[model samples]
Target: MATTNIWQQFKALIPEGVRVVATIAANNGNGTSQAELRDGSVITVKGETVNVGEKAFILDGEIKGTASSMAQYEVEV
Candidate 1:
């Protein structure tokens, strides 16, 4: 599937009030690397590594559970 649709599907599944957690142990390159979660804090498999010219992981954060404090951490490569 394409990136946008996958993201849209993810958004659809998540309830409005639910919290989502995003963490990273290590990352390189520049574009977003998506991890395959397996009910663990760490990604089950190594994600695809994009390049420096692309965008950073826009989803890294600890969910705030509130509307205002939506924490977003951008790690510069």
Candidate 2:
């Protein structure tokens, strides 16, 4: 008998949504920031001070929900 890994089997359970992989290109230093995504699209987020060069996840050009630092989702797999 072999043991099965539940994580591997359930990994697909993660919902697929609009996930933007981008880097903070600029910060206005006034609660506004801009990120340049891999797809060559720039999105703006206000009320958040994202440092330049910092990787971030943004959805719908807002960081209110479904957004956070990329480091937070790092998985040691």
Candidate 3:
């Protein structure tokens, strides 16, 4: 018989989600809104609390909450 390892068991549970910063582009006027990432790519996220032209934190295609306007920098070693 096969055995389930710790890593396998962990995978079964709800894993952590990845959050990204984005700016509100447009509001669908329902419960979702359009947001734009730093890369100039746009994505639809769920949330209308944040106004247009504002930054927010998106996770799992849902809006967790508003985000700061601090600048971001990529570093390489």
Q: What is the Å distance of residue 38 in model 3 from its true position?
A: 1.6
Poorest stretch of ten by lDDT in candidate 2: 64-73
Identify the runs in model 1 with alpha carbons over 4 angstroms from their true place.
Answer: 1-19, 34-38, 41-77
| Sort by TM-score, top down from the best | 3, 2, 1
Model 2: residues with Cα > 4 Å off, grouped in runs: 1-17, 64-77
Using lDDT, rank the candidates from best to worst.
3, 2, 1
What lDDT tens digits, residue by residue, belong to model 1 across residues 2-65? 5677788899887664234433334433433433222544441233342322222323332222
- lDDT scores of the candidates, listed in order: 0.38, 0.66, 0.88
Q: Report the number of the highest-lDDT candidate.
A: 3
Best of the candidates, TM-score: 3
Q: Which stretches of candidate 3 lie over 4 Å from their true place?
A: 1-15
